[model samples]
Target: MNRKFWSIGLLAAVMLISAGCGQKPGAAPDNTPEQVTPAPGGQTGQGNEDPTSGAGGASTGNEVTKPETKTESIKSYYTDPDVMELVEGTANISYKEDQDKYEAAYQTLQKSDNPDMIPLWEKIEMKSLKFDNGTITIDVHVPDEANLGAGGEAFAIDAIKKTFFQFDEVKSIQLLVDGQQAESLMGHVDLEYPMTR
Candidate 1:
């Protein structure tokens, strides 16, 4: 009988030690990576806890954390025969360089749309962009100038100006056609002078 009691007591002690070893003091068991949830407010969570809440307590609404935003502003143009206005939009150009930024901006303009707005650079090819001091010169190849209908030249020019001028580094823009400084584009806007931001 003494041997039986001793064996039972030893078994109980071992079970207790194993249970205690499974969990640390004041800490929860580690969760598997697959069980972890993402953080609040669209941010990624690091662990199995609510990311918006503090470590010690529930989160206050005011203490909510926000994910870092990666975006750049591009100025888009909309023309109204009665009035002209500036329309601003955001683009994912944070990873782009200066030339890439211009290309991205132009591509955005190409894709951007508004019921009252006319798209610029439609069917126009962007050959290259050159930066010198504060001046930005763009060489373009227009397959057809007749595509720019009535008052389209002004709107196109405005769109180019607003888009490139969004960057402080560009103080002026000089348009080039087929690698030469044409006197005018589509016989509407003069290309002899560089447009200032």
Candidate 2:
């Protein structure tokens, strides 16, 4: 029994020495250590957290607010495959608070769900959109590869106008190519600036 107790005391002294060696110079020799926790990224850290703060870290007031998102019904227009006229298609758009609603609606116009409908806007990329009072100005980038004729050009413009005019706030629309007003969108029909609803 005496040899067993001496052996246990030696083991306990070695453990105490090992634990004390790891502690900081001025740190108090704690009989009962405060619960040490695993920090973020699976890192083990000393339990030196402020009692006033929330469990994980700082207070909830410092937490970043998430951006609100909403899903809305969007009305988009496509060109008829046969007549090349405007065909309305309704879709649901989900967007964050800071995102542009008009851009979402405009993107929906680039795709058609109906088999008979054609997506004319797919030929051109919308660079940007600006609104003034009630007028919507659209800037587009038309690649040289797009071989759109006069009829296609007219129907494309018609689709854009029809799609935007669905909104009550839009009174008129002006089209721009590469941020400049051109005599024609594709050297076809004359572009009527600020086409009114």
Q: Write the per-residue lDDT of candidate 2 for residues 1-197, one digit (tens) a residue.
A: 99999999999999999888878644645564443445784333543354544655544344334557888897777767775576777888877742377788788878777887778787688998887788888899888765478887787778788878888888998889899888788788788887888
Q: After superposition, how far is residue 143 of candidate 2 from its true place, in Å?
A: 1.6
TM-score result, candidate 2: 0.61
Candidate RMSDs in Å, in order, are: 12.4, 12.0
Where model 1 places Cα greater than 4 Å from the true spot, the runs are 1-70, 79-94, 113-115
1-197: candidate 1 lDDT, tens digit per residue: 99999999999999999999877743634655433334555443653245556544344344434434346765666444333543455445543356666777777666445555545665678788878899888898877753565367667777788788878888998899898888776676675468895
TM-scores, all candidates, are 0.54, 0.61
| Model 1 TM-score, 2 decimals | 0.54
Q: Return the top candidate by lDDT.
A: 2
Return the clash pairs for model 2, or none.
Answer: none
